[model samples]
Target chain A: MRHLASILLVLLLTIPSSPIFSQGRVLEKKQVALWFGIRDITRDSLANTGDLDFLNYLHSSDDMSEYQYLGVSAHLWFRGNWEADIKVAMYDDFAPNNLNIKAIWLPMKNLGFTAGIYTYPQLMNEFNMFHRLTDVGFFGDTDSNFRQRRVQESGLTAGLMIPFSYRWLHATAYINGGVSTLSPFTEKVTQKMINGNFKREIRYSTSHSPALFFFPEVELGADCFTFGNAMAGIRVRASWYTVNRSVDYGRVTYEWTYANPARNEVDNPAHHFSKFEFDAGFYLTW
Target chain B: MRISTDRTTRITVLISLAFLLKAVSSCIQPVFDFDFDFNKITVTNLDNSDVYVMRNDRDTMYSSAIAFEVTLSDEEFLAAGSLPKAETAFPGFTPATAMSPESLYHPRHHITALRIVTLEEMSPAIPAGSDVTGLFVAYVPRYSEGFLYIITDELLTMINRDFYPGEPSVSFQLFCNQDITASRVLFAITVTLSDESMLTAQTGIVNLLRAR
Candidate 1:
């Protein structure tokens, strides 16, 4: 805990100080800012109909419900074109938590790109959204300590931010696109079957594939009547994602053995599963 | 000094090219690796009653019956009136002539019926002074020949207790059942115990002819 506090103190002192130092340099284009906000997260699980048929069962058999959370983020900008940001968030249900690091580059005034990696110490809405639409093995309920789905995503995100001002009101409209990969923790399933006088075994393995999606963000706010060098504003944003997923439900067969006869057999082995998600968040910037 | 028309055109083209490049660079597809295997089968028993088997075979369609024996633990044979409402509920036993006798062996039929038994007499081993506190039933389905060679398929059924609009309860059960006999006889007898948690475990099949 003390080490974390020291790290945070260093970041705070350095990030704000860099902008001040740049004020004495030529062009003086550098800027540094930090903002914190709260957000709510919701998720849905992907439906597994084919699994139901093979398993000879129907019903959720587990809890699938909506969840909400509060989160905080810190961002640092430097060299007029590069920025790095980190976020920490937690949910009430299951006490889901997450930490992420992101880097962005703006080569020109109208264009920007970003990449990032993230992990969930607690449940996150983004992870839940992906699992509900793509994961078949996430069928049963799990405890908070169990790391069901922890993913690393690296993609080029580009956006154009258009600024408009009318008297006291200022608005920004942005659009972005990117591709990401979701790597599952468990990658294979093996099944053994017995039929007549033969015993057969089959194994199913899944590989990683890329998913493409688009995001458009718009915000409208106003600078509070100047209070020294400080101002406050609020913004709302939403994103829509489209991705494909494949879940391999293992193979089936009947094989008989002579030495050891196996009478008990598991009938339904595995399922191939895949879904799309739309997410929106609101934040207050100061 | 006025700006030249050629210079304005150059600026417009440069802005357009920058936007185009940004859009192209952002076009990325994420790779998703999913290692989910759905081949596992899970079974569970929710009812408190224990099941017993009188007969089970893959060769004959009329070979099995599920018997529910009620024993009085006290000296008097307690009247059936004192039992729970489930005791008086219609057993819903459709005779073999009505439908396929093999259907009785299906797990769906077993869960739906309160009791399944032939009219055969059963001996109660309780002491004369003991009152009947509980009952055990052994259910056997009459099967047609060549049933054992047939493969049984698993079925997953999701029953939402609160499926109605504005309902509160989100709890539900996934019941997994398989046909023991592949033929029309359906008299194959297998009993497995399970809970409402992770669906795992195997059922034991009893060969009645071998026992006899």
Candidate 2:
């Protein structure tokens, strides 16, 4: 803890001090910034939900997953201490993870309201982690099958951006509220017969619905350099957002039928999509 | 200059809003509630309960012999027959007049192979108190001219429970690879109870005859 506090203090002081030379230089008023980063996502009490039981089965230390992404934002400085920015980020593993357009009104230099469409998208797949097929030597050539699940999400976000800037050192904290829609969520089961004659497939999904959500973000970073009409910085950011519900239920249907059809529909209730993620990346402004 | 600047700002804001809307719309896709597939097929019940030799039918018979017959053409007599079903359920499954085959050159014990499937149906859908635990198969060739074979251990696999929908409670499958030109074959099954008070033995016959 003491070491952690020392690191925090050093980070706090890393913000550049007021320029020693009393000379002002012109910087780009309208600029585009690109960022490459690594992201770590963690879930809160949400992990207690049984839907995430596979996490424990798969030897995940906890309910956390990591990703990498590229982020692009265009900043336009308006009048006074106000800036309008549009940002879009795509994750390396999945598709576009976040996209939003917001106006930051810094009336008091450090505090501002940031609002726009902030969609959080996530995907997870685990294979054969469940105890479905047990090896019994009775029928040596029988077929064996497995199960897997995938989840997706999107949301609209509005919030406040508070920056603590000291020279080149900069830190921002944000809190937002919005509606999140988790859709196209699917869980699948597939069976492969050893005889190689037949197979079976089934998929389950929750009906998509929009629910209220809370999203908060914190970033700590410092400007790195200015080279040939451009600026660069290293930033570490963490964000958390989730739907308020405990479990989302859905209808499950089977895709196979023999001579006669079997019972097909069942109700599966589980937790909704929610995650807390941390990312560290370099941002280049041009 | 101020008017032009205002106009440019309006255009930029409009374009930004349009882009955001398009991205949001693109992200939206149809949500499927649940879809799944299973590869295994398990039979918990037999489809034809009436066609097989049943445990109850054997118990009621007084004679030590149960008999049924099938007459086949020369081609069928030499070739394998149709798959058998629950015997007790079909009167035709029992001893019936065999019509002589088209080219009846009656070879002694002409049947190259025979498969007997027996089904046991419980009233309350449970095990029997005193059940016929096993089966013994003997083929009497040419109306008792000679006994060809009796298959007990290796050929009898007791199937007690149903595997598919509409199946009986318990079933036994017996496969015999013997030349059964015999007019009849006898099956002797014994039922024993926990009290050890009464032990019942039953017998049945399948008589083979030439089709008319």
Candidate 3:
């Protein structure tokens, strides 16, 4: 934790002295902003025939409720249309922590592009693993036990951003899409016997369908106070995103008393999610 | 102007030639000549039982040679008793041993039903006492959907032997009664036992007899 704090302090001190800090014989590209916000995401779209398929086979209903998330981000602006940003956030209940970093390019004053990597936990909550203390019916009553659920790493992201302003208040809207490698949970019961040596394989079949997200943001009441060399304001933002989810399971073997011992291959179902989120937060610029 | 006219004519001729070739290719239908085999049938004992018998009542037991045959028309194959049915009552009874009549009809006795099931359908039903063993045959038709040749209880029996022990094996026979025009046929039998036993070493020969 101390190391993270020191790194943030170093970034704060060095952003102002960079060569891109000057604009038109004055400080133009130099800006350090810190932001904290609360966000809520709700699942929207599922796979084709996913609801009916799950109901007929698994005999369960799909429930989509709004989940709250708290996050912090730091932005550093440099001269010549170059900037860097980092965001870290955590969710409530079974929500996992998400971290993202991006290098942005601003060809013109109003338009920009960002490319980065993102990491977050799996959206599906495991009943046996985490919510064992809670009622089993909360996650759906199934005889199967959940053993493992882990974080998923979204390898890369590339998107475009557009910023608009009205007098002192400014609004920024962005759309980004990229391909990623996904790591699913391992269901190996003997995984511990082998000292957890089991390595989850990354699925590449869904790479053709690049994960896409659109963040159309509006900041209200942006211009207010300029304290010393720092500027602070309060704003409300809403972001909506969509992504294709691919779940892969290896080989399955089952034998019963009345049936034959069968060995077959099971593939992950293709799933898509549409999320709508709103966040209220404060941003500071210097 | 003359050069341009010649170039346009050449392009039109090439396009016409390509269309002619495609039309000719689409008109020709390739004939697929393949053989089906119905020569051998082997029933392996999946459950714990020395002798597997098709029984109707909870108390009475009967055994019969299960029969299966394939024909060209769907009506002939769907006829009742063309498949095997479990005998309901046994006339010659000697305590645990009895023989059923050759010609007897019982309400509860019927041929087992076999249908194609996906993996997801097998998930929940697998843990329960659902029989997953049977014959699987692949049949291909010219314009019709391909169907599997499956015999649920006609040629097999699932013996539950928690009450009896010793030589745990089930026996049944496959009787081919219909004339098959197909050149060759293939049959696959899958068996799952209640206990994990190394019975992979067991082997038996299937006798296929032509109907008189």
Candidate 4:
């Protein structure tokens, strides 16, 4: 999975060197640039979350987590106030974080509008492996031979962005809403064993995409060695998402018995969340 | 004009490459591997008593050769384990119903034929005519969306419903009638099961005129 993401990153990097944005080149209007950056992300769920936890059925592992700095690799392209970008985020042994590909149109000065498609991984494994606690003894790992991967939560996002410029200080305040495609899936797998043989599997899903999200953001810095074509900057962003419901997936487990349980018969509980995201980033663009 | 066309071509190529990369990445995890080991069938005609008798009214026949038992136990990667030990066989099995007749596309499994022949005839499925006779039976199971297959007769009877080669080991007798002639006859049974398992066994010449 890591190799797959790495290949995608390579393909995105190829865009800036492409000749499409080259011929009619001007410093501010027609230019090609690569923006690569390091980012740190932290999020808190804001909801009257229930006594239900999806972690009780997953295997234990010490090397997995929900957040990582610069976990998502993104690419942005711009031409005459119109831009297109894609971001694919993956972690937890390269399983999945989420993926977003969108376009932006700046119809007037200081303001821009955007729309795009996005997909998040199944929240069951996302919760268990990334967020759910696995070190809690028997609850963490039900079976050692068990493993699972959920595909995605996919949808469309629309938002507006307002940018302010003051010499070397820049800031963008943006808000967005998402509506998802109705997705439901099920999985069953058989495992071969030493002393015993049994079949195992997990699944079932439904999700609510974000309705609205925004937080103040600011960037500060200047052109260091390169004057017209290059600049370096640092940015701090805080974001909040309105309460949304996601029933991404439910308890994935081992041998329900020697007998294979009915597939897609189990349903996950609804998770309502208002999320918070804080990011600190450093970037170089030319 | 030339430069603009070059730029357009480059843009198209870049976009295509990006999508292609995305496609290749998301398709990494594989699901549902149907892995089952090839199996073998063990035939036992306990005690090698290979003879059958034809008596009018009095008792003249007591033979073990006429009955053969076929057993199929899964090959497990365990050292020493108790017999029928789940201690915990867990006692039940599930069968899946095929949308259509499994025989339409399913593999063949059953006792091909049980033939009785003279010493001069070959040991295979040579048909029985005025003098040569054999039992040929074949049926494809209706349900093979296989689930836990426990090797027990009671469960098998429910799941297979008259399917041949019913259990791990089932006994079958081979005798025509009381009015039959007495001669040395050889017994042969050819079987084929799931996972491409095949078994063909033939007993040596045995006296059928009277039980020894």
Residue B85's lDDT within candidate 4 is: 18
Among the numbered candidates, top TM-score falls to 4
Residue A276's lDDT in candidate 3: 52
Residue-wise lDDT of candidate 3 within A57-98, one digit each (tens)? Answer: 111124343445666565666556777766655566423256
Number of colliding residue pairs in model 3? 9
Give candidate 4 misplaced runs (Cα > 4 Å): A1-8, A23-65, A69-79, A85-98, A120-143, A146-151, A181-184, A188-228, A241-243, A246-269, A278-281, B1-147, B150-212
lDDT of 2 by residue, A32-131 (tens): 4556655444442222322323222221234345555666655555556776666556666434446655667777777898877665444443433331
After superposing candidate 1, which stretches have Cα over 4 Å from the reference? A1-65, A84-88, A93-102, A115-170, A187-209, A249-286, B1-212
TM-score of 2: 0.42
Residue B165 of model 3 has an lDDT of 16
Chain B TM, every candidate: 0.19, 0.21, 0.22, 0.33
Give a tens-digit lDDT track for model 4, residues A160-233. Answer: 87767787666666666766542554433333221111223333333332333332233333433445665555
lDDT of 1 by residue, A1-286 (tens): 2244345445644654454444434222222223333332222344444331121111112333222334444445456677655544444532323444456676866455666644332122222222233433222111223323333333445555554668767565556555644443332111111111111222222234345545455545554544544344444333343333332333232221121323332223332221111123333222
Q: Write the per-residue lDDT of candidate 2 for residues B1-212, one digit (tens) a residue.
A: 35456888999999999886665445332221111111111111111112122233322221122322222222332233322323234222222326422211212221222233332222233223423222224322222221112233322222111121111111232222222333444433332222332222223434333222
Model 3: residue B75 alpha-carbon error in angstroms:
71
Model 3: colliding residue pairs: A260-B191, A260-B192, B35-B184, B36-B184, B36-B185, B37-B184, B37-B185, B46-B193, B50-B169
Better of 2 and 4 by TM-score: 4
Between the candidate structures 1 and 4, which one is better when assessed by TM-score? 4
Q: Give candidate 1's error at residue B107 in angstroms.
A: 45
